[model samples]
Every structure is written in structure tokens, then in C-alpha cells.
Target: MIKKPVKIQLSEGLDARPIALLVQEASQYSSSVYIEVDQKQVNAKSIMGMMSLTLLPGEEITVVANGTDEKEAAAGIERFLVNVKNR
Candidate 1:
């Protein structure tokens, strides 16, 4: 298993539903991907779990990945976040 800490800067404050969908899609590529906010952790694969995160703008969320293709997972998510920025 491999673990990587990735930080993402939100382009704007986001609603729970859309953010959850993004995380869910990310996890589909790799189950090891996870999102952590306010000391609470959730599996990126679970939309419900990700919705529960409720992150705010400018928050540096930490993504932790542990499993096969962890590096790929992290890289994928990092690129996704940057590309989706509305700002």
C-alpha cells in the first residue's frame, strides 16, 4: 500500500452534492482515494460519505490514498481539481 498527501485549493465554496459527486468519480478510478476535512475522513468512492465532508473555500483539503495505483489516484485528483476551477 502507498499513501500520499495531496492538497487541493477550492476555486470556490462548493455545495455538498456536487463536491460529493466529484469525489465519487475520483474514487471510481481508484478505491484507495479518500478525502479528509476537519479531522473527519470519508471514502471518496461514497457520495454520501463525501457529501458529509462539507468543505469550505480556500480550505486545503488533504487527500490520502493507500493501495495499488495510489500515485495515479493522487495525480488524477490533483489534475481534476485544477481543471474544474471556476475561478
Candidate 2:
């Protein structure tokens, strides 16, 4: 298992479009991926689960991955959350 912390960078926050894009990116990995906010965690691949979290801009979150491709999955999510903005 691998875990990394990241903050949502979008000024507009994680709206519907960004969540969908993040979900799409997460679904590509074979590892089990989850996003954690406060003490709550949800499957990154589940759109409904992600939306339920109501993540906002500048909020700190954790990306966790565990599986054969855990490292890749964690890093990918970190990269997406850290670097990608508004898409």
C-alpha cells in the first residue's frame, strides 16, 4: 500500500466536471484507489462516493492505493490532484 497527501488546487473547487475527470483518471488503475478527507474515505472510482465528500478548493486530502500497481496508482493520483487544474 502507498499513500500520499495532496490539496485540491482549483480555485473553483472540485465541481462536477473535475470530479468526473478525476474519477476517469482513477478508474484506469488496477490498484484500489481511495480519497480521504478528514476521517472519511471513499472509492476514487465511484462518482457518487466522490461527490458525497464535497471536497473544496485548498482542502487537504489523501490518496491511497493498494494492489500490484499501488505505487503507480498513488503517484498518478497525486500528480493529477497536484498538477491538473480545472479539467
Q: Which candidate is the best by TM-score?
A: 2
Cα lDDT of model 2 by residue, 14-37, tens digit: 878878888998999999999999
Model 1, span 7-86: residue lDDT tens: 55565555664575576557666447877776787787777777666566566677777777777777777666655464
> Model 2, residue 71: displacement in angstroms?
1.0
Ten contiguous residues minimizing lDDT sum, candidate 1:
1-10
- Error (Å) of candidate 1 at residue 2 is 5.2
**Candidate lDDT (C-alpha), each:** 0.66, 0.87
TM-score of 1: 0.73
How much lDDT does candidate 1 score? 0.66
Q: Best lDDT goes to which candidate?
A: 2
Worst 10 residues of 2 by lDDT: 78-87
